[model samples]
Target: MRDRIFRRGILPIAVVAALSAVAGCSASGDTDSPKGSAAPSGSRAGRVDPRSAAALRAVEQATVRAGSARIESSTAMGGMLSLKTDGALGWSGDQVGTLRITYTGGQLAATMRALSGASMEARLLPDAYYAKVGDTFARRLNGRHWIRYGYGDLATLPGGSGAYLTDQLRTTAPLQPVRLLRACGDVRRVGEETVRGRRTTHYSGTVTPAALTGEDAAGLRKQLEQAGVATETVDIWVDDRGLLVKKAEQGELVGGRMSATAYYRDYGVQVSAARPPAADTADFKELMSTRGS
Candidate 1:
């Protein structure tokens, strides 16, 4: 198995330099935000008021609109990475990766993946992804051959993607708390700052049951951690237009640290309600069994 970190479209040196600014430590819980909130089993969404409800609804709409645009995002990761179990893995220090997404009028058409950890590049076509490590290559078959691939899940093909992130940003009804206050429950302003040159609206609140148990949130965590992972803090950042500009999570898992960050750009496209192909049901069952074993 060949697994390594990758980078694209930017200087590896510069990317590393940029990532160096981020501390090599985990962010502690901030009670002011929902990320620090804990979830209990068998819970339902709490009652939210009208004004806060409108704010959340507007935020959700803006997020969907932003996701409708093409985007390019870069991330720098550092950790004791174990690519495979039983010690085939070694440690990877501060490494950087860049992902590029091509969308035509808000529909994802292509994805380019590059990682510096192992020097790999992969291109994803609609239903399949071609991965190349130097002159060697492998093919990952995506079951969905009809619907196009989303950028969120594109660059991280077979693992996670920009498309997956976009889907999460597109929420409706009770699932969309940022859109309606009654759906959002309690809210607190977490102050504001500029991101990528855009003035943004920043608010942090406790995670409601609807927030925690929702399919999108659960799917996001489950899909990212198919191999069993632990992470801390799920943050949602909205821009001035009330759109979610970024979503980030940071945490430690398996003896190594792991993280996933996504940015929403270019909004206003109609998306299909398609889902990422499920990992093999048998494999999933076996994974659960082994975890218990």
Candidate 2:
């Protein structure tokens, strides 16, 4: 039981990462090539108030044009876990970046404490995201220090956030919040506010799989429904330049309550993420196969 602490604790906690943010664990080039990018959820969508809709459109275009940003975010999924991520993410190309993920508290944090204490490194790419869980993981997984989760492979998991995170990562560009808000059809400006000392405009809206439209609405709706997300409240702050500066989302999943807040800065910044050495990494799919065998 003592020896299995780290290994056994990874899956559920990783899923929470996905649920709380557009991040999570798993990867490997050694497995069959992962499937394709995931499809997002959506609903029927509301008829937007023309003016508000146009404003949000500008935010989306401007944000997507910027390409990348530095992020500091925190998430708490009810009582399951609480974590903070400090990293940079790039969407100019395929998603590529790195984040220092720290489990601050909650049940999962205690399990993680048994391995790397409380923090880990997540390397993200378009194809997979690798979790570096320290040397203990290396020794346990045949000298592999990293675990690779391929998006395509994650999609095959029946009830895991593997697929959800993949799909979100593919779609969760800095401009994504604007697009989702546009789908709300009733997005409203909540007056001006100051974030991190910068003046900004705040917008609030409610979104559900059944009311989301635009882009891949139907597909996302189904995916979200499968994951038990009935409705979600979204709030975003946009700077004078129409760039998204921050966003907060709250909702309930099949597991419990989930909430995440992320701040974006230094748009157009350079972000780099290099894949780890293959010999030092284990693919979750292959690991499962080995255990099954």
Task: Please give each candidate's TM-score.
Answer: 0.42, 0.84
Where does model 1 exceed 4 Å of error?
Answer: 1-53, 65-67, 74-120, 136-187, 205-211, 214-231, 268-293
Once superposed on the true structure, which residue ranges of model 2 sit more than 4 Å away at CA? 1-9, 12-47, 156-162
Could you say which candidate leads in TM-score? 2
Candidate 2, residue 144: how far the Cα is off, in Å: 1.6
Q: Residue 177 CA error for candidate 1 (Å)?
A: 12
> Tens digit of lDDT per residue, candidate 1, span 1-293?
22221222122212211121121112112222343332221232453345545666676555433434322332222332111100000012111122222112111111212222233332222333222222222222122111122323333433333333333222211123342222224454445667678776664333422343332555433433432333343345667677666544344434354443445554543222222234411121222223323
lDDT of 2 by residue, 1-293 (tens): 32343235355355336323632111101011112211122432464567777888898788778988888777776687777878888888788888888888777777665555578888778888788766664677878878888777665454455555556556545555566577655467667888888998877666676777877566656557655777776677789999877777666776787767778889999999999998888887777556533
In angstroms, the error of model 2 at 177 is: 2.2
